[model samples]
Target: MAICTHHPTMKQSRTNGGRKKEDTRSNAIRQSSGISNHLFEALRALRYPDRARLLWVDRFCFNQDNTEIDLMFSIYSKATSVIIWLGKENPVTKTAFEVMDSLAYIICRERNGAGMKGDNISPFAMKERPSDCSLFLNGQDFFCFSFSRKGPKMYRLPRHGSLGDDAIFRFNDDRLWTEIDGILSNSYLERAWIVEEVAAAAEVNVFRGKSNMPWSVFWAAYLGRQIFAFKPHMASDPDASYGAI
Candidate 1:
């Protein structure tokens, strides 16, 4: 998978007489605009130059002020390969990539009629089965993350109540797949849920006047087990000895 990092330009705020004041509407608008520009720049850096076709980013294409446009963008996220650019060393970036990679692998294997190993099951699982079914049912739980200048952070935002065995079973019900597929395909309401679930899972605070936190801190919580990291230079350089997890 290709990796992209978002670097946002944030404005420092001041406390007024021991009381914190909310950002003015105009200031909020300016910050949003800056974030959008940063998103575009990140996309440009991450894109494969030779391949004309690349992933789509909402900040560049969607109008933040328009509800209709925002809903449309949310729908698009479910269908598209989304990369949240929450700056460097973001925990959200790490966890999101981990979840996305696992989901992608599970989905691809299942689509081709394959099964994943039991030992590889994530700690959040109750019993060992094919990862594909688990992902299809519980993938949304791993979607929430926070994005900030400090980095992207991840959270456990589950749509289907708890992560117990019974809940997992219900999520894997045949009826649910039909509904999920339909949601994945098309429909405004379903799409809204998909976006909302992902946004919630990602711990994204789209509203103005919120506390700021580092993204890396959120993702670090989920980094236990077989997760691995490597330097880009090490991967690109032929002379370098690449290590395995």
Candidate 2:
């Protein structure tokens, strides 16, 4: 697995005499396994009853040499899974994960139950989706079939005439958008390097603390919100080719 996380660092004390410390951030991760950040904490929390989880975190795994730097994209792309760390944990983030879990259940059930209309997003169809994909509110798979015996909570998805419990209709409404955006506008998403990281991954997870959501569900809802809320004049056809969306 590949972990994409925000590395928060602090300046260490000056040495007895000479020059300032170079590569403190890298040093921190190496010396402490990112104890100062959430990456190690989140990884440590990943547990399974049966076997061990192998991970390839950028901070500790990479040598920080030219060869490793050059292969950054390669490492990310080749990884079987990608875990995105948003931040620590909070009540608002918990609710977000609940909503995300519900969405995943709704989408999966909708796809399984003989056919629904809007945005036929079938995440259970793992043949089409990488099984390594996942998302977290606080950072656990709320719907991992193999890991968790308890299934995901199915929330009502937004329909054309009906609204769901989610923030689908709130994109245009700055007031409602802020509620969700406030929690999501953390350090991770604001980075300039995350574009390639997110786009290249066949499977990805959005994590906060312990709550989680499937990336597919999040993406589908995101597109739905964008098409409907951002531009009223744009085509909202369910069957229309959104191209990658």
Candidate 3:
């Protein structure tokens, strides 16, 4: 009789484990894509040469819960420098830059005025300290995005030379501020004053579209006490071309 050797049989691995891992990876990708939609489109418009390396973009850095430590740290790190879009759709980047530059120049001049001068001041020193100012002061170069209106809108004010109490719409509107103060605290009022002073100087009105309350009420009740107003005309049209101011 011929000697027969029994061979051991090899078992096949299960497909279920690999399938589950793949499913999990797909779900993670889907979640990440969803979060990216919430990021402000204007900030995205300014092309960052090394965006992939910069951390703080909500989509890549933040977790679904938004309370994650990594996301918080990334946001804190990049909080100082921010890109404010002029509009929600088709922002005029060049125009916005020019406006900001002009405002910077104006600030420099104002700081060097006699009132701001001190014994320690130098003739060649840069006069303006925008960081010290509490208002936007950049004129009507910014657009506020309204979630309810589903669009962005520009805030406009009268010309720079226009002066006098009547030149501003809210010069006599002390009642509005009183009502606003009732709703918001004193600390909030102080902060709003700084923003308001800047807005007033620019002659621009602030608007928050798509809120339950009317623009007047919204301004007086919330934004008004804070010294901001609502201007419906600033709404942005996505189809229009963005031009330099």
Q: Pick by TM-score: which candidate is best?
A: 2
Query: Model 2 residue 228 lDDT?
Result: 27
lDDT per prediction?
A: 0.32, 0.43, 0.28
- lDDT for each residue of candidate 3 in 117-156, tens digit (9 for 90 to 100): 4222234233332345433343332222222122333322
Q: Name the regions of candidate 1 deviating beyond 4 angstroms.
A: 1-37, 88-245
Tens-digit lDDT track of model 2 for 1-245: 23733222211111121114323543565366433344444554443334444555655555654465666666556555566654455544555454434445444444445375566434223222123433111222233321111334342432322333224233254433343444333435555556666666555666555655545655443433332222232322232211110
Whichever of 1 and 3 has more TM-score, that candidate is 3
Arranged by lDDT with the best first, the candidates are 2, 1, 3
Error of 3 at 121 (Å): 20
Residue-by-residue lDDT tens digits, candidate 1, 1-245: 11112212211121122112322543465477664433433433344434333343444544545774445433432332234343222222233333323333333333233343433434333343454443344334334444534465564433343454335323334433332222112222233333443443323321001112222222231221122211011112222111100
TM-score, prediction 2: 0.46
TM-score of each: 0.26, 0.46, 0.28
Query: Comparing candidate 2 with candidate 3, which one achieves the higher lDDT?
Result: 2
